[model samples]
Every structure is written in structure tokens, then in C-alpha cells.
Target: MFTVTPEAQKEVSVFFEGKEVQPIRIFIHGGGCGGPMVAMALDEEKDNDVRFDIGGIPYVVEKDLFEAGKPFEVAFNGMGFAVNSSLQLEAGGGGCSGCSSSGSCGC
Candidate 1:
């Protein structure tokens, strides 16, 4: 129940060079300063996941998580990707980590 913007698809294709990308898995993480955020990674299809083909890329989302994150969109933010879940995910500015003046709290 999510859409992947063309730019996002192009980025994903570049990530895998189009021929070797694996099924992508979407997940939630609590590392960013804003709090819990959505992320994606290459993953094998799992029994608990429901497959979705978006922009010709294969994606697998855990059934329960998918239900909770419907009406979402995956977009490319030029430098990277973003997942927008109808405002459930807010923009968490980048460079808010180590090596940057902003430390642990990202402030």
C-alpha cells in the first residue's frame, strides 16, 4: 500500500546497478534525533512478509507493519531516500551524528 516515486526508483536501481538488487525490506529504527524512523535494507523474502512490486523493484514488508504503514510513500531526497507515512514520519535532518559538531542528542 505504498508508492515509490520515480526518483526513488532510479536511486534504488543505481544502488544495485539494476541487475543485482535484492528484495528490499522496510523497517523502523530509533536512532535519529527525532525518534523512531523508517529505513530500508536489502533482505531475502521472509515468510512473514508480503511482497510488493513498486517501480519494478521488489519489496517485502512484514504483514503487520504494512498494515500500520499503509498510504505511505518512498521518495528520493536527492542525497538519499525518505519514507513518508502520511506525516507519521517527519523530516529528520542529516549530519546529526558523529563527526559533526552536533553530538549524541543531535542538537
Candidate 2:
């Protein structure tokens, strides 16, 4: 059940506007060194793909990926869109460790 938040639905419409509309394809992206990641792209339907509709938006995912990534959700982060999965992908920490101006870390 890949779901799209309301704000994401709007963004989706805007993103594909004036372009050829295709079902949003969701799949797990193996980052290897970085970690397992989920990604989305516009893709043509495949023979083994499963289709689902969320908020009137259609999406397709490979059967196995769908089983693994059920209950997925798409949301708009401040900078861009992000795919949130039940599988947690932890971030590599340690940011803003460098010296800062004034008394605050810019980050």
C-alpha cells in the first residue's frame, strides 16, 4: 500500500504536468556502501508489476518489492520529495563539526 500524502499528490501533478504521464514506479534502491534505499521514478508497466492507486494517483511496483515495501508513503521534504519506508535507513551522523562563525554551527 504505497501512499502519497496530500501535499505530495499536488506535487506529483505538478511534476508530471505538460509531460507524458506514467505510473509512478517504486522500487528499492540498493546503495551498497551507503545502505538500502527506496526510490521512485516514472516507469512503464512491467509484466510482473503490481498496480495500486493512492489518492487517485496510480503507481506500480514489482511484486516482490511491493511485498517488502508495503505501507510505504511519499511526502515532501523541505527541499524535495522523499520515500519513507518501514525499513529504516539510518543516516551517517557527524555534521556541523567544523568551526563556526559567531557562536553557532551554520548547519
Candidate 3:
């Protein structure tokens, strides 16, 4: 299962406060060149999504994308909050073959 770090949760809570709707997190499981990659966004919840609490913030994931071995973590980089993936989607010795651009692997 995925988990949101305390720092990320705090940021999200502050950001969504007083908004009309609760912020929704989306996990898009396809991008880049490898056919299936990872993407995330914040928006209204979708119909086929599952809701869960992480570090007190609400998170949503597509039903199909919710797998048994998910290793997700929510953290803050220098600028803002971000979700990190534990699943290594790299491809090949040098780097990801599907990742055409440097550090552009959409995993």
C-alpha cells in the first residue's frame, strides 16, 4: 500500500483547507515510452477510484492500479510535496531504454 509522509500530509492539509471540495490524488499508470508508467495529480475524485487516508490526508487511486505490492511514499522536495515510487521501472544497464530523455523516466 502507499503511504503519505507527515510532511506531505501537513502540506496537503494546509493547501486544501477552506476549499469547496476535498483534494483528490490520482495515480495514472501509463506514460513515457515503456507503455505503462506513473503519473500523479490532484483534482476531484473519479468514479472508479478508491479512497484512503494517509497521514490524515485523503488519497485516491484507480481501482485497477491498486496492487498488492505498492510501495508509494509521499514526501516534500525542495519546492513542494511529491509522491515517490518504490517500484523500480528502470530498463537496462545504462538506464531506462524507454526513458528517451535524461531523468525523464515517468516512473
Question: For this target, which candidate reaches the highest lDDT against the unseen true structure?
Answer: 1
Per-candidate total of colliding backbone pairs: 0, 0, 0
* Candidates sorted on lDDT, descending: 1, 2, 3
Q: Which sections of candidate 2 miss by over 4 Å? A: 88-107
The local lDDT score (0 to 100) that residue 45 gets in candidate 3 is: 73
Worst 10 residues of 2 by lDDT: 92-101
**Residue lDDT tens for model 1, 1-107:** 67899999988878777377689888776545555677788889999998888766898878888888886678998878888774375535554544345556644
The reply for model 3, stretches above 4 Å from the true place, is 29-37, 90-107
- For residue 24, model 2's alpha carbon misses the true position, in angstroms, by 1.3
| Model 2: residue 21 alpha-carbon error in angstroms | 0.7
The better-scoring model by TM-score among 1 and 2 is 1
TM-score of each: 0.75, 0.72, 0.60
- The whole-model lDDT of each prediction reads 0.76, 0.74, 0.64
TM-score, prediction 3: 0.60
User: Clashing residue pairs, candidate 3?
Assistant: none
Clashing pairs for predicted structure model 1, backbone only = none
Q: For each candidate, C-alpha RMSD in Å?
A: 4.5, 5.2, 4.5
Better of 1 and 3 by TM-score: 1
